[model samples]
Target: MTGGRSPRRAVAAADRTRQPTEVRRRLIVEAAVPLIAERGSSSVGVRDVAGAAGVSVGTVTYHFGSVQEILSEAMVLQIERYYAALSETADRATSAAGALRLLVDALFTEDTDRHWRMWFEYWNAGEHHLDPAFAGGQDRRYESWHRQIRALAERGVADGEFTCADLDGFTTRFAALADGLALQRLRQAPPLTTQDARRHLHRFIETELGPGPHGVGLGPAE
Candidate 1:
């Protein structure tokens, strides 16, 4: 009949057929994460996501009910990856204090900047519009983050690495402090630097936990 399809075209068609719906859905979300990170949630659209994912616009629409749905899924993926990486880094440490230090160090670095950006993008969109899709699971995500910090504090106290008088208070304050500092740093409010953020976080840790075996602060930003 007509000229046959090229090997590359045939392979591409075969690959598309072989990819499962779940795999393609995940791909769309993964692609959306970076696009939302770089352009923000309000700026990115389904067309942008589809192009990035190398899938048709129809495929994205088929998988996600709306742009908000796609955005929410992307945010979920971002949070999961964020925690997994931080947990992995902290796991390499020998003690609870060491793990806290590792976790703080990992938080304000370039490696995690994109994650933070994407998080804020989603948060701001949700806050401004009060969209349910953007608002969903936010509290649960924050609780998970708080739990990680609380667990570290509890472990330190148990291991004699920390002498916290109020575990709950310290956990709440520490988590809040980190979030505030990160927001300021991300916004460059007063021109805050990563070193400044890390230093501030470490000082807060030292203040709350006191310098000891259990309160292994990073000392200062070098």
Candidate 2:
């Protein structure tokens, strides 16, 4: 063997050493998401995130000031992913009512259980730890969610698919109902099923929004 590294190997080494700081920071955040999901934010540490991200503890600290910061960033990333997917799926619906139906279906399904778990964990961490960043992020995220609901409701009203005059009131109540039902489903204290949550949401929609222009009733939940 030669005494020097090959050209390709040397380029690869250079690339690793020259990796962009922001990209490396994002990698650490991405890796920390699942860990936070699996083990709450209070339990995760810089070393654990470093191991998960396959980087040194110093590397993680170089990007974030503390484990709390890393977890906060990870929570923000997860929330973005969650809302992005929901928006994408809702966009595929042809009508406002259809979009609302699709959102309820997507939100209460077994597929979103992990996402709900992470969200609840993040909320708890923010409240118990008194993290201003986390609290502000949570408020911003919920406001976005409420805006999404308001937009859909406005579209429905404009299209003559719904007859609700109090859009703001409806949006607030709808969001609160969904959050309460989701918490019940997550805790299983009352043994709420996905189907139960979906049906409850749909019923609320029918009651508040008038079941669209076709008088569509809340049938069996899928």
Model 2, poorest ten-residue lDDT window?
Answer: 1-10
Residue range 62-96, candidate 2, lDDT tens digits = 88988878888898899899999999988998888
RMSD, one per candidate, in order? 6.1, 7.3
Candidate 2 clashing pairs, residues 3+ apart or interchain: none
Give the CA lDDT, 0 to 100, for residue 213 in model 2: 65
Off by over 4 Å in 2: 1-18, 128-134, 211-222
Backbone clash numbers for all candidates listed: 1, 0
- Per-model lDDT: 0.76, 0.80
**TM-score, model 2 to reference:** 0.85
List runs of model 1 lying over 4 Å from the truth.
1-14, 128-136, 211-222
| Candidate 2, backbone clash total | 0
Q: What is the lDDT of candidate 1?
A: 0.76
In model 1, what are the clashing residue pairs, if there are any?
Answer: 161-214
